[model samples]
Target chain A: MKRIAGKKLVFFLLFSLLAAFPQIVFAFPDEGRFVFDEAGLLTEAEKEQLEYMAQELGAERETEFLILTANDTEELDLSEYIGKFYDAQYGTVATNPAGTNAAILALDMENREVEVAVFYKAEEYLNAARRGYIIEQITPYLSEGDFYGAFSIYLQSVYEFMGTEPGESPETDPLLPDPVMIGQEEPSESIFFQWWFHVIVSLIVAGVAVALMAHHSGGRVTVHSATYLNQSTSRILNRSDNFIRKTVTKRKKPQNNSGGGGFGGGSIIGSGGGITKGGHSFSSTRGKF
Target chain B: MVIHYKCQNCGDDMVFDSNTGMLSCHSCGRRDRIEDLPEEFITARFTEDEAKEYHCQNCGAVLITEKSTAATTCSFCGAGVVLADRLSGDLAPKKVIPFTISKDEAVKAFQKWCRNGLLTPKGFMTGDRIKSITGMYVPFWLYDLNSRVQARAVCTKVRTYERGDYIYTETHYYDVFRDINLDYVKVPVDASKKMNDELMDKLEPFPYDRLKEFKTPYLAGFLAEKYDYTDDELTERAKGKIANYIESYLSSTFAGYHSVSYQQKSIHTNKTNSQYVLLPVWMLNYDYQGKQYLFAMNGQTGKIVGKPPLSSKKIAAWFAGIASGTFFILTVISQLAGGGF
Candidate 1:
């Protein structure tokens, strides 16, 4: 009878853990190094350049920097896949005078998704507005099959966007090999402001509709009341409005990049750096390149 | 300095007839060609101080006019008199768009405009109580400007993605610029303070190609006024309008930005060329309930635009009609849903 009772108790405890596991989140410290190219898209020299730049930027800004590219996610449930492995292998403190907040940029080649994970604490440097700008800088190159150029631009822009003094390398740990961390079902990612993004999109769409309606109102509405405009001939003298800058943004693309890769019903989330899958909400802007 | 045309065949006064668009003699029934008039109309010149009044030789009636009044009819004999001085010197208009449509046609056009759409009052101007219809050569200042516009804006583009347990937002910034060169010609601003700015604006798109050189015969049948406002006063209006046009031209060029806001705007006018001219307008005024309702027609294009007073009764009827229609539809729909169909 006692043996049977023990078996029942074990089953009950296991059941309880399974039920509560999805809701539980774990916070981990930051790692000294940031740039990781798991997809092997970057060369040894290029990888070293990105890592060096990220490390210098991280040390100066006191905010963690990560640039990771991975192949297809292992057959793990997408919601459970996160920066958990990276989180557990990194820093000791959440916020120090020096800095340690999680900000990860993950490029998934198989799925054609470029995920940027920003932690709550590091949101100041990687705010909503700044993130949108960075995507614009990276997408054109991404669509044009220039992954290296795109990644390089992204890394440099991020470094500058954080308001860091370039070439001013603060005291950081020496270079180390990439850590091998097989992630478990641990949560360490957070997201905020999905509704706010939607609201902004709605307002923009409505404004565009109203502007179109106004444009078609009348011919008289567009020009001033000088009768000569109808009779005047316009000449373009030395006409040039060349592109000063070329940037592209992504906003929930049906397909990723100009490659026209068909998207499926699968998702893989990143976790870590004081964030988890359950209560730590996350928001991202995506679109076709 | 007032000039009048006389019938060469009958030796009677020849007046401009609106229906025939020619000088017609009422006594001898002689029709003369206006283009056949001599070239003295071009060489002739007069100043505001050179002419004050004149007497009709045939009718023996005195005609009085202001310095700017170039054309009028004798109140006693009803003879068309042209103040040649008003059409000359500094007061002379370099260009003139004569009244092509007659008074009868103008009144008919006004009535047709009142019947434009459902929003207009049903019987607003159909009662033939059009108190007065005046053909006026509204003084205008035409401007020719060559401008350069440069705009600077802070634009943002946002991209987003999701990985594992987190969604990421990626933002980028751009320093956007637009350099535009705009050459505006024949932008007209009314130089007569007596004309309603709004009314004149609605009478836009005057046919400028038909503009004829200043001629004395053109004024014989029409009432004309010299400019009261100087170029300096109207320049402010013209510049304001140019600035608005260039700004709109710049903003329309940008596309595909999540958010774009202008940080700096600069407009430079290389040179402004101006001319004192006159535009033709058929001005119609009606008095309803002691309130004057004015209607202006573009004498060139005949496109009419104006704001007419709304009738409260009409509005109430519209609301009632819509409400009842909606209520009936809902009632039928609900009954069908309840299996009463």
Candidate 2:
């Protein structure tokens, strides 16, 4: 009877172990090469800084994150080139297939574009706010042709940003250090997070349907094409446009810490991204340095 | 009288082929030029004051297509005949834009419209589905309205500038007035009660220069209708069209203002004229899934318009496709474009 109780307890413990942490199901992704500074633009000191940051982040996150800098892309579309380079350098594993847990930031000095490619969960985790915040910080340096300084700051920010949770929730885990951000952009004040975005999508789709429903059943609205009317016979009596009241809307402009801000708290503004090959997707906040 | 041209080479029937816009013999493929149409047509009233039957002189076969059909081919003998009594007097068309689009072309247009985006049911464009094709001469009354428009508007201009940490917007308001006199020429409304007003409106701006004098040859081998609505009745609809046109015209003059609101407006007509006429249309009727689909194309300009039957199945599929796409994409865009939350 005692042995039976012992076996039941063991089974129960094993089941709980699987259930408690279902998401940590697989082994950590293999750490591939993390830096491809082919541009040779980075000095020895700058290269060392990137190498250390890349190695540390790779060890901590188990994501094959890379920081590549090249003088000019060889006639390849910058975004496409970044995707191909990411696939070749790390040759993503099937386990972390879309690099969902991985990311790569490629900076091109000659053509002047910054690309951050994220795979799999990294897209959902890194989020747009973080991407925009990071880009705002590094733009000023790149515009001034400071490649080493730009990359040096970039490496540090990525290390710090990866620690921050997705969605930038107010509650932070006590164990992990909060992110240190540069160019601290202000978060949105409105609780209407994606309202406009939702409205535009709804409008386009509904417009097509509403338009189809409106006249599809057969009716006609006389258009404003009165130019067909005889213009010479009609004379103007009186016409004028009078001024009316003006409305003032105040948008909470983000606090621009372009001077020097680290990733503590800031919302990314005007960041855009899209999907790449092999079904791998990426999100980025970028500025020209 | 309806006058149909015949093929001299063969005893078979001939028709005014719309594809070639000429009188072509259907049996022998011979084409003939119609030179006597203008002189043969007379605007005098019919002495009989009743509809008349026409018999082919060549084969002694009675020619009948539709009650309003002025000209037709003998089904038995394949000879063309024109009903002299039907188009004798007031029944004669004052002007005509002959059928420029052929039957095959109109059928092809219907097929293309049906298959666009798979909006209709499967096999809706099957050739066997077309029930009938009729070349119709639809009657209309053209109105020329000359009017002076008076309008008063309150307009606004807004300017914005940033100061320190705040943005300021200044709006200036003014009262404006405008008086414009305009002449509208040839706004037409269908005068035939048989024609659907909505479908007729889609066929517009027929080149008036092509309108020849009252002619008999133009009505050959086609269905036609005489105007049923008098000038007094059609004037009302034409006036409404003119008023709407004038209102929009007056409203358009107030450009460059931030905003404009109407105060008062008046349109005074100086002159109005109405003329009875006929326009050509190619019509195809299709009955699909127990519902009728009517397709009409302008005979002059080939501007085609029709209401396609909505496929419930296709609509459901489209909604599913668009909804899923919008849902996934909008979510991703909102996160990437807006705040993290």
Candidate 3:
């Protein structure tokens, strides 16, 4: 009886270990990672820095941020792929996990496209318009093949927006206005549109025109020096040129170090919000590279 | 001292005709070539005191004249008179350019020129408001000048190239010297004190090919003036005119240099010859807005020189239009270039 009990215990231990393997892989904090670069678009150093930033911000905001890249989605659409990934990690709508907030940024290399997927409480902050604005800001960096820049902007924008209330401008403090709003309003009152600018310019033009007209009213002198010159008798007698000294100067040339080569001919996709097959509601903006 | 030409066919006084270039009769349409006339008729010989008052030959009226007036007409009789005493001896002119443009042609040309003034005041172009237009013979001195120029300048030549990671600039300095001789002929200087020098200078380049030997008949009908300043007194002015030409010519010889700065330069000029001559001009007096404006036209070439009053309202409108156009263009350009980048 003792020998039979030992064998059964060993079998039980093996079965439990086998069952726990997937749980470890799918767990969020267990992996302690936010970026998965399947496309190999970012350098190792860039990936490290982004990981550090996402970990710090995610902890502070009490949310999970995930950035994913793929060589291609094959026949599946980018949104469908994102939904499947989200379901595999957090379960489907029928078995949806409670008290979880996750914002996912996914890029598909083959289509040169990017999309965002939000889960749980994140949906309340990043609405369609706000998500579109974030994507618009990062599209230029993505199209330039600056994946590192795009990821950093994504993390920062998400953090700032989540801290503010819904239906509000994305400002760090809700009481103060957005800095970008001030910038846009300043130009309308610029000197180019002012009354004094037009008046001063017109006065200058009028003064010059009148002066020129008055000057030319008196006719020009038609007779030049050659008009009365005795050309035959005029001659050059002597000429000499002696070189005195020589000097030389040298200067170092300037160098240019631009970021990276761009993925040319990139374009934007349609933007909208919809519930995934897993019943996770999200607002997504599409950008191309 | 006043002499008048009498028409052989009719006893009426004859006047010099600009169109026919001959002595013409008004009552009878008879014209005589002064060149074919007797020497006595062409040259008037008279002895009179310079200070004495002169009377018109046709009318016994005392001619109101200035001291420098050589030829004028009788205001009462409207007869053409020539003062022979003032035109002879030391006050004589060597050459004369007779009036090729008549009084009617000059008036018409003046009106056309006025219409071409873009900034002139309203209705000023009609030219019907001219008070008087006088055909006058103005005295001038034509000078021949020769200049000797010697110059020394420091010049440089620069070359730039890229080698490896550095840009190299090489400059070579040169010491240049030049000797030149420049001669200008028939540079005219107006000797009349009454005429504006600036206006007269603008009406230059009279056709010297039409110059003829001076005869009293050329001044029979037109008013003439003797020289207020002699050629010897105006030599300095002629020299000043040719100084700019000499400097420009000196610089032309020192070409092919990046930059040139003159260290030392000398120019010595000498007057070779000067002759007294009479050139034709049409003077116009116009009255506008209680003000008198004077205009002068070259009788031989019909070149006009004068300033016309400008309209303030038109200038304001033009300024507004240009400013608006420029502003519109700049705004569109900035917007199209993504807010000027």
Candidate 4:
């Protein structure tokens, strides 16, 4: 008994330990990687830091810039080049120069407008920006040869930026509407009239229905059988049962002098006990024939 | 020799009444002189082996002879004064928690439970529909065990660095150890074959301090029975409960691990003692659409828990409303987008 009990205890403990394995295994968030755009929107301090860190970490840099003129819209081969740049930044193209860190800067010649987009690494950039520092801190240091110092400064800057109190950023408003009320106007006359009319019509219909029901019901005995009869009549009319009966009656005719005569007297007489009554039955049968 | 008392001119069997403290005789109106028995006769103790068993005359159910003396009525039939069967075993209960909450309280608790479940169907709470709420002292084996769990896992540390054009990944591994001491209390293993084990477990953690000596007087208004499962079976279940907790605690403590391979893992549990006690529960059975649904409420705490029947028509209507509303909203949005009003 003792040995058996020992085995049972061991089995139970093993079962419990196995059940809690999944919860313990996966608990950490994924690592962070950042992408930077051109036009120097990021602070110089951030760019220098990122550059030094990139060199120290042996990270590759890929950049592509394009200028487009709205006047020359016919021969615009910008899509092929943009697609290539996108492939280099996001696609699994090893030899492509614009790998991972590629930022596309599109210059519209006609409008004199510029649009910069960093591919694949926007989350990293946002994380850095959230720390109150920009890419400019790391980029310049990467241009210089002190890779170790640059990387250290970049990491410290990111940590410091992350440690600082977060303030409202422009990125928070992309899809969300402003909280403040923009404009106010009086209710439209048509919508108001529509609602009022519906309410008035519903009330009038209810009132008329109640009045008619009351007027018809006063001083009259309400036999439940009468309501059933009304329901049956409505059902018959809706189903066209009367029309079917009329058609069937018009097609059939009596053949003999007997009141119930059709195919034969013997056959009809057996089934037509009520129709073949005494006295005026023969006269009515003759009239029918 | 026949013991009889004469009432003036007539003779009849006469027994002493403890409450009235007088010997009364029928047939002829007369009171006989009462004789008091020694204190030893009034107070006697019977061990598990010595206790006698009595069979219920009405249902043929057997009960211990000791229990029969206190409970004049049969536990099975609620019928009066049945002779007890012969006691044969050495496993008689040493203590029992008498019913504190009465039958009326149980019924009220059941009705309150019904009222609280607002979405429950109508006609369920009607007084006539309640067949019977029999109070039964269900048999339970409480096991206490001290557990020691040893576990190991491979911890991971991820280091990411870019090498020229590509990011290189490196991960380090480590072994984790955990030594835990657990004192498991009152792991109840239900003895009834008919009762659901899962449901019983869910209705657990009853305070054991309220337990009192087994007295048949407590069985007067409530229903109760001894456990069918032996101490061995219950001990096994208690060990299982302890193991579950230990594993959960270990897994939580060893977070950020890639893979956990437990080696030399063992749990040692020692049974300190065991007790048989009675806990109160209000049970309700509802029949809907030719099917029975069972609900139970903890009598002492008044915590109600049960599954209710779902209406197919209401579910269909809800689904139809959702689909229609979604389509209407989407259509309106698309029309506005297309500038078609």
For all candidates in order, the CA lDDT equals 0.59, 0.63, 0.77, 0.41
For every prediction, compared with the true complex, DockQ reads 0.04, 0.19, 0.32, 0.01
Q: Estimate each model's TM-score.
A: 0.53, 0.58, 0.67, 0.41
Q: Candidate 2's error at A45, in angstroms?
A: 50
Tens-place lDDT per residue, model 4, A69-95, is 122323433333334335533454444
lDDT of 3 at A191: 63
Candidate 1 C-alpha error for residue A161, in Å: 64
**Superposed Cα deviation of residue A284, candidate 4 (Å):** 99
Candidate 2 vs 3: which has more DockQ: 3
TM-score of chain B of each: 0.85, 0.82, 0.91, 0.63
Rank the candidate models, highest lDDT first: 3, 2, 1, 4
Q: After superposition, how far is residue B227 of candidate 3 from its true place, in Å?
A: 0.3
Q: Kindly indicate the candidate among 1 and 2 with the higher DockQ.
A: 2
Write the residue-wise lDDT of candidate 1 on B109-194 in tens digits. Answer: 77776665344456674666688888778889888777777777877777777765455676677777777667888788898868
CA error at residue A135 for candidate 4, angstroms: 26
lDDT of 3 by residue, A1-289 (tens): 2332354356345434533342332223433278889899877656665676688778888787889999978678898888777877777878964635888899999888888777677887776545665666678788888787778778877877678665443444342234334333445445654545756766677678767767888787887868888999987888899999999999987774322211111234556676777787766767655
lDDT of 2 by residue, B222-248 (tens): 667766767677777777777777777
Where is the poorest 10-residue window by lDDT in model 4 chain A?
A280-289
Candidate 4, B165: how far from true, in Å? 9.4
Report the error of model 1 at residue A146, Å: 61
What is the lDDT, from 0 to 100, of the residue B30 in candidate 2?
80
Interface RMSD for each of the candidates: 12.5, 5.9, 4.8, 36.3
Residue B164 of model 4: what lDDT?
53
Candidate 4 is scored at a TM of 0.41
